[model samples]
Target chain A: MNWKRLAPPLAVLVLWQAGSTAGLIPGFKLPSPLQVLGGLADLALRGMPPGHRLHVHVLYSLERVLWGYGLAVLVAVPLGILMGWSRRVRDWIEPLVEILRPIPPLAWIPIAILWFGIGIRSAAFIIFLGAFFPVLLNTVSGVRSIDPLLIEAAQMLNAGRRFIFLKVLLPGSVPSILTGMRIGIGIGWMSLVAAEFTGVRQGYGLGYMIMTARDIQRPDEILAGMLVIGLIGLGIDGGLRLAERRLVRWR
Target chain B: MALHLEIEAIQKVYPSESPEGRVEVFHRIDLSVDPGQFVSIVGPSGCGKTTLLRIVAGLEARTSGRILLDGRESEERDRRIGMVFQDYALFPWRTAVRNIEIGLEIQGMPQQKRRSLAMKYVRVFGLEGFADKYPKELSGGMKQRVAIARTLVANPEVVLMDEPFGSLDSQTRNRLQDFLLRIWRERKDTILFVTHNVDEAVYLSDRIAVLSPRPAAVCGIFDVALERPRDRTGPEANRIRKEILELLHRPHTSPVTF
Candidate 1:
């Protein structure tokens, strides 16, 4: 059914290849399409660093997102549920979340490095900041938005509080929570570039590759790194779409 | 038939700070139903027919008065009770069989046992081919069938239906009415059907209770003495329909479908 959806992207790719071959795109600041492709192959075979592969950079970025986003889900979902269920918890936690959420995640990087000492922990912390609020707010709204009649129906059918929570509330809020996860992942990806810029002092990732390439005026490598990041982000969202289809099929 | 349920002096007050201090949705509403009876509550839109049913089903707390089941006051909903909502409320994430399995699952029936029981009702409701389909995948009529099958499979002592067919088109509504009559006759299930449609109330109910405007009270209760599978266009049916419409003076207030 989505076969027609591919046409626009393909057309853009064709135009990009044509523009590159015709030298219509400036070579100094941008790479030709073929040069970018070649750059990708070069990185795959022999990476920017001594022994690391292209997959390593990708995995580093992905692993950071997984840990950060996973931690956000783990922490925020329960807190959101508690806030949704009880006025006391909501009132207590509301001010803190509201205050902290508005500040962009990059603002926290310097403090995160000071707190976490500049490595994977620091990167994960910043990404977590980027992701936590979306999941928390969405879960809260999801739980709040449940049709009360559904809960009443469950109770009328003899469901205990625990059963109603697990069966009625959780399933009812799933579509909303899934929406939160999608948005959270995108933000997590965006923050990955900034998070990795925090001077890890060891192996570098795609973000570091882009930064180092910019210093060397190798836009080809920068474009290739960006392509990988974009492609991987697309893949992650694609996985979520598949899960949305499987888990929330009725919607 | 034995007296099955008695709702006595029921009152519901929606807390408000208006000049009257609080808005009373309904008060001192008294009614009783016998076992194996089909009763319909018909009224204008705001007469609280639904609120009365929900109170009877124990989904909402009554401000005062007692609900007697088998001659004893009890606030807890009977496990042997089921309700069909106006929206069908089929749990969009579940298939037809799984939706029907909720009641049994709450009863702690084993998975295989519940599945088979659901399958049986799927056939009973002529939902054979659509059992595995999700609620959105089915037509309006089909979804309503699944909702009914879900409640009937519970083998409830009383089934409360709140404008269940209000969402269907006229043709589907008539067909479902016939299908429901067949099922009701076969099981002799006690039902408290709520609606605003005078024709529907007069046609399906053994006793039709007319409800007055807000702070809903039972205006009157008239018995339908016609034979089984009563003709919709028959003279007696027509007379009862007209009488019921006149009784529910704020008539033709069909609840919005979906």
Candidate 2:
């Protein structure tokens, strides 16, 4: 919304265009924006590989992210709230989560392939791990940050434990929960590329197509695939920002 | 509804690091408010005035004592109590009207009935224009008005205020005092107001209870006896204020039970 904030990206684009025009980049190594767009148009209209349009590749990755991120939210949010609200739960799980969280989601790829065997399910599992930690950790932080006075006020108003949890704790932690979900979605999206790079079958995801293009020596197609990934990632992030602005009207 | 209140020998002590390693805050304090009588507690800071009020409100427990409301001991009964906090303590997320209706909503009152009741107080306090506005949107005095309206919406039997106007400017405080006096006169429910301001104590109270410092004990209770609608700048009010201030300033020593 602020033009001044957007100047960096505009300047980078201008520099890239200038560098390409001045022949600073070797043609085989670096394609101009126009060349990338032309290759992108070709990939979008004509099939990238075996009846798979670039849009289909994007949709394949998107489907995996949605399922994984959705499941992560369903499981992690309540667990995070429980861990935050009670000391016993936190003590029991905190150590396990701490040790596991530092391990990148990609590190689980071998186990995921062994368990689910080179399919969408394997990809979804890796994406789930990517999303889960961010949402869970952020949700816990959010609940802990709530003001004690608000809790006292709810207590004085004769709110029961259930009512307080639902009405006070949940709404109070919403902004933080949303923040966690946004971070989780982004991480999950990033993890999907690696997840799809494994032995996926019956479909071409953006990750799969990028690898295939690299093998076939179509660097332009590889660049186009990377551009699509960046654009889609940016779009998802923008959607979250819009939702955050609308939902956190109080904040 | 009327409240026949009783406080039977309430004692409070806090741990300290002196020769005794403990200090008595309040000592076997006994007081009672008759049905519909407005009693005000005046004392210096750190005198456990607010502690005493909290004990009565059931927000805190006494060291050893009993509080009876209408002849029965105050247990976990909801007693139709109202509280106006010094900081206004309105929920930041709720609008003025919503804040006023919060107690009713908790009681599961229907939305229309709650709104109707909340609207009456909103109109009475000249807060109709700001009914839909949040606490942050209102000025200090306006927020206090909303707080009073919020308390009054429940039609509470006993309204406990802890320095309700302590944070406001002098002009707003005076205006709110006059407004409070009018509300008390009209409603006449049992009101226990705790304040450190001597002028405010005499101006609004039917009877002023002066409390001692630190290990708080009630030194004495003085009947205001000044005329109603007592103007802050009026001669009678000034005389009463000076008398109350003199009582508050007196150095008294008595052996208080821990």
Candidate 3:
């Protein structure tokens, strides 16, 4: 609906198309926008390796992300709350977290393959490593940043320990937790794609399709796959932002 | 049922980085509120009026003190006591009626029963249409009303208010003051209100306890013998306000600890 937003991208695409048609940009190194569109149509209709369709690749990638991100949330949120609420827990766990968090998730690929093998488990583990710290740290900061007066007010209202944790602490930290989730998902999605680039037993992933396109010397398909990955990331982030708006309408 | 509240020999000391290595915020701060009485603690800013209220509410630990509710030494966090804060302290995530229901929910009241009871207060507080609105959506006055309603729905025998109307504009403050008086008249809950506003203290309290500056003690206690719906600018109210102001402005003397 906003023409202003559409105009810049349109202009770039037109310039790119013109450059490709004039041979200023080589096809094998960089495909034109039209060639990328043709590649996309080929992926949807004819599949990447004859039988592995684009939709199947998308579904597999989504499944991996969901599994990894879900597990990260389940483990991180509770741990974060405990770490935030108890000084002893924080003191014990913070050092381990600090030591591990700096290691890139992609760097864990070889170790993860050794541990879980070349299946979905290794990929999920890599994605989990990518997602976990953001969720945990955000949740911790969220809980810690809550107004002490709110806790005091809850105490004055005779809220017991459980009530304070569930009602006051949990709800208070939601905004931060959501922000963490958004960041975690972004990183997890990226890690999943990169993890798939090494190898996938299922032969179905956006990253695998891109790698195969490179092997077959189809720059157009590679560009098309990259665009798909970016669009999916945008969609995932947009979905999270919508959920955040609903959850924190008070903000 | 309202309970008499006694704050006896309350002391608060904070470890400090100064040469003394400790700061005594207040010591031997003693005050008492009769059953169904409205008492205000007025003092200069930073005189520990809020700290005193926090101690009474059992939200802060005192170095040494006893808070007696109806002659019994209350527990660390007495269910019979509740507090309203200057910032309202309403759960921003909760709607008005839900915020009002928080204490009841903590008491393990049945959901339907608590909802109906909270609705009654929503109507009583004239927050009828705004019952489903979150604190952020409400005006400053409405948020305070929700905070007050939240505390009152649980029917706390002793209500500790620490500058509950401090953040509002003068007009909203006056309106809320009147609204609070109306609620007090209806409920007759024992209230210990803290404020820096001398006029507010005079206009609302049955008794005003003036605290001296830091390491504070009750410097003076004045009974406001004014009748209900008393004029804010009346001779009696003005006279009491002026006396309290003068007491606040006086140079601090070493507090006498009992």
Candidate 4:
């Protein structure tokens, strides 16, 4: 709502338009903002490849991210709680996590395609890999960061092991878990786009649409696709922040 | 109902990196609290006062000791024993009333019953409007009140307080002391309170036990027979405070029997 916050980007856009008009910027390399906006209109009305609309591509991307990100949260949270709660579980799993964590999600694309073939499954698998570590590591740190005094206080109240885990550890680590989830989804969304670039069986994805645009030398459409990706990423992160605020209102 | 608590020949030793291989925090620390009596343990800093209370509360292990509750050897993690920590230790996530209900919830009491019971203490502690507020929203005095209410609502046989008001400003401390006295008078709960303030000990305790420096042990026990609402700066209270301070200031030597 603040005009001051809008000024910098507006000024940059004006300068970019001026440079493109002056022929100082090559249109073949990067299109002006107006060209990208026109490309967005073309994608919405005429479709990227004449029949596959921009909305369809967005839907496909969202579906893959949901499947992957959901599975990552389901697995990582409980496993993370165990690893954080018990040194035994952590000792058993930590080495494996360490070995796997540093490998980029894109690096897993070849193996994922080999395992699941060129479909949503391979794309989802890559996203899952991208999301898993952030959630897991954050959850571990969340549980560990709890003050020992709070646990002792709960114990003094005669809280049993189950009660301690459910009431104390779970609630105490929620803020950290939410943070990890936000980061995880961000990474997962990014990985989904990259995985689509490798190959998608359905022929419907933002990355694939951009690839088609590149094949036809449509730089404006490519930039438009990138803009959509950026905006959606911002929306997702903003939604997560809102959820975090609601859950951790005590802070 | 009130209960008698007896700590017999308690000792604590921690492993050390030094040549001695172990550090004796305290040795043969003995004390007893009669039913409905308020007892205070006052000692110098790092004299193992908090450790002693933790042992009594079964939160920490003693190298050697027996904690007898109403003449029976108390079991580990005794539910009948409750503690109020110096930092309040209120769960920041829970509201004031919910924090008070924690003990009852652990006992598997029905939600409605615990809520009503916790509400009663919220009023009793004068935490009326703040019952639904979280710990961060409350002041230090309010948080301590919530902490005390949290411990007391469960009706533990004996309450162990480790400097519960130590973090509060002087005025809040005095107000809380008076608040505690009123609650003690009404409930007649057996209490073992630990504090470093000689005046606080003199004001609140029915009996004050003084502990010497580490390898701490009870060096003196003075019966404060002063009347209720006793003036803090009064002659008798000051005299007893002076005596305890003198005992505490005396150089660390062999434990002296009073």
iRMSD of all candidate structures: 1.4, 2.2, 0.9, 0.7
Instruction: At residue A49, give the lDDT of candidate 3.
Output: 77
In candidate 4, position A148 carries an lDDT of: 92
Give DockQ: model 1.
0.60
Where in model 2 is the C-alpha error above 4 Å?
A1-8, B16-21, B77-79, B251-258
Ranking by lDDT: 4, 3, 1, 2
Docking level of model 4:
high
Q: Give chain B TM-scores in order.
A: 0.93, 0.93, 0.96, 0.96
* Ten contiguous residues with the weakest lDDT in model 4 chain B: B70-79
Task: Score residue A34 of candidate 3 by CA lDDT.
Answer: 100
Tell me the lDDT of model 2 at A91: 96
RMSD of each: 4.4, 3.1, 2.6, 2.3
User: What lDDT tens digits, residue by residue, belong to model 1 across residues A3-44?
Assistant: 999999889888888887888988777777788988788778
DockQ of each: 0.60, 0.42, 0.84, 0.89
TM-score winner, 1 or 3? 3
lDDT by residue for model 3 (A27-88), tens = 88999999999999988888887789999999999998989999999999999999999999
lDDT of 2 at B174: 93
Number of the top candidate by DockQ? 4
Q: Candidate 2 on A37-131: residue-level lDDT in tens?
A: 78788779875674688888888888888888899999999999998898899999899999999999999999888898887888889889999
**Candidate 4 local Cα displacement, residue A230, angstroms:** 0.5
lDDT minimum window of 10 residues, candidate 3 chain B: B74-83
